[model samples]
Target: MEILVCVKRVPDNEESEIEVNADGSDIQRDDLVCSTNEWDNYAVEEAIELVDEHGGNVTVVTVGDDESEEVLRRGMAMGANNGLLLMDDAFECSDGKGIATILKAAVEKGNYDLIMTGAQSDTGAGQVGGMLAAMLDYPYASLVNSVEVIDDKKLKVGREIEGGNQEMNEIDLPCVLSIQTGINEPRYVTIRGIRKVSSVEIPIQVASDLDISGDSVGAASARVKKIDYFVPELGAGAEMLEGATEEIVEKLIEMLKAKGGLK
Candidate 1:
């Protein structure tokens, strides 16, 4: 089945520091180096594997400036048939909801059997995947660790849960899945594949092109506001009680119970 894998380019955490912009609002990227959001690599890989097993194509899409093409090319080299870069000045300031809205519109424009995205983006708030699914009116499963073809038109999925629990679900074609990390090991781009898509000019779409509204997105439109950011201070060194094994164990238990560690 045809699949659309959504990806994003953000500041490389390794090379960037979080600093408020001049407006004292969102983080600034003027001095930060960009890279593909790492979690999305798994989404791209999952799409490639799905298309390889079933006879179909994988299309990777990202909303960003022209530089986003770098990450899109990386997806192409990993086995996506083509890529779409949805870029616009408005998209530069998009919040999670706005990004989801754009993605919903883009997916609607394509004839896709399934859509895939990472569980969350490294930058913005982690709400786009579920929000996009809702906007598209498609069934969604998040934190998916495994996916299998249950039938020609159905898929079985396993989602990771807290406390070592796993939730299994089944959904028909034309659904959305937010893939979790450790779902599968993503493949690296080979030199030959990299060369092939390096010069290929992928298509571009803008806000007006999609008839999307800029006023509905970005910090200006955000429902949640960041008051401020400050690192929490660490406390003093741990207290140690010198005693025999049994005494120490009892003391530890008493301390834990007193702190409500064991309820």
Candidate 2:
């Protein structure tokens, strides 16, 4: 059961103040503290645990600049057997689909029994896992919270549905799963663990190495883009009813009556 887990480096919201850049295109990255995406850590941990029980190897992959190597190293420190970095100048400003395209190429190059990705990125977009599964023509499940081995060809995955219910389904092998946090507590990567994997060689794959064409990715190819990033102005309809709980409830009733929101 060889697993490929996709990890990402993201801003540490707790460690840095996230602000929109002056151009309103993206977040202010310079001086921002960054680390492995929290959800990706859980994904990598899940893969390692699965491999531990089922007998296989876990490999972590990420697509970013050289600095992004840190996240791969962290994943390796957490017990992944190998780390892979996909970097290329042409991969800059890639949208979700572009990232998925790059991941698809890497997946094609590996004989993985399972593929895992974080349920969502800090950017709040959970599109890549589904898109990558679609591009690879593999079955995919998102928000997966539990995994059980049914056989070499099948796996029982549990997902948390609405109303806090758990839904279980049997998915075929060679599938992709977007792992949800709380699936398990990720093991801590101690200094000793980091040092142990410090000298391990992590391979790098570029756009050419992955057979990804420049025109198909990067800023020029992005169909969806952030042209601006600004907070929406407060609407006139919004009201703050300040008082004791009872008074506030009465005030809310009056406002609702005035607005025809309540019968």
Candidate 3:
């Protein structure tokens, strides 16, 4: 069973900042450093676990600029057997469909048994995973918190829905899963693993090689469009209510009732 895990490089949340562009169509980048997208790291961890349990090779793939190779390397250091980098200038402005189209092409070339990705990216739209599933004509499950291989061709997955409820489903293999972050506590790359794969070659894939194009799956041809991007104005702060415990409880209850927060 050959599994392909799609990962991404994003700005570390702690040092992340969004600088609005003049057209508000994109963010202005000045000093952005790349790290693995938080949820994608969990997906890599899950893939590694599957490979460890069942004898199989795990390959980590990503679409981004050369700097994004860091994500693939990070995955290799975590236990992935190989890395594939889909790097192209045309992919820079791609929306969800375009991104998925590229990924679909890459995965098809490998004919992977299962494909996994983060439920959403930290940047742009979070629709890539579902769009990729549609392109590949694969059954998809999103926000998956846990996954267990029932057999060679089946999976038992737990997904979180609204209101803190979980939905469990038995899905067939050769499916796409958009994994949630809390699925596992991703292990950090060990110094030994890093050094071992440090000199390993990473396969680079090109859009032209895939024979896919912007006209085929670009935003212009997308079923959805982003009309605008705006940062909502930050509003007011809270008022402090200082009093005894009883007084505070009464005030909180009154406020809640006034706001219809209580029945």
Candidate achieving the largest TM-score: 2
Each model's C-alpha lDDT? Answer: 0.86, 0.94, 0.86
Off by over 4 Å in 2: 237-263
Q: Rank candidates by TM-score, best first.
A: 2, 3, 1
Q: How do the predictions measure up, each by TM-score?
A: 0.83, 0.90, 0.84
Give the better candidate number (2 or 3) by lDDT. Answer: 2
| lDDT score for candidate 2 against the true structure | 0.94
**Cα-based RMSD of candidate 1:** 5.5
RMSD of 2: 3.7
Error of 3 at 167 (Å): 1.4
Candidate 3 C-alpha lDDT tens digits along 25-115: 7565557666888889999999999888887999999988888888899999999999999987667656777788999999888879889
What is candidate 1's lDDT per residue for 59-90, written digit by digit as tens?
Answer: 99998887889999999999999899998877
The clash numbers for all candidates, in the given order, read: 0, 0, 0
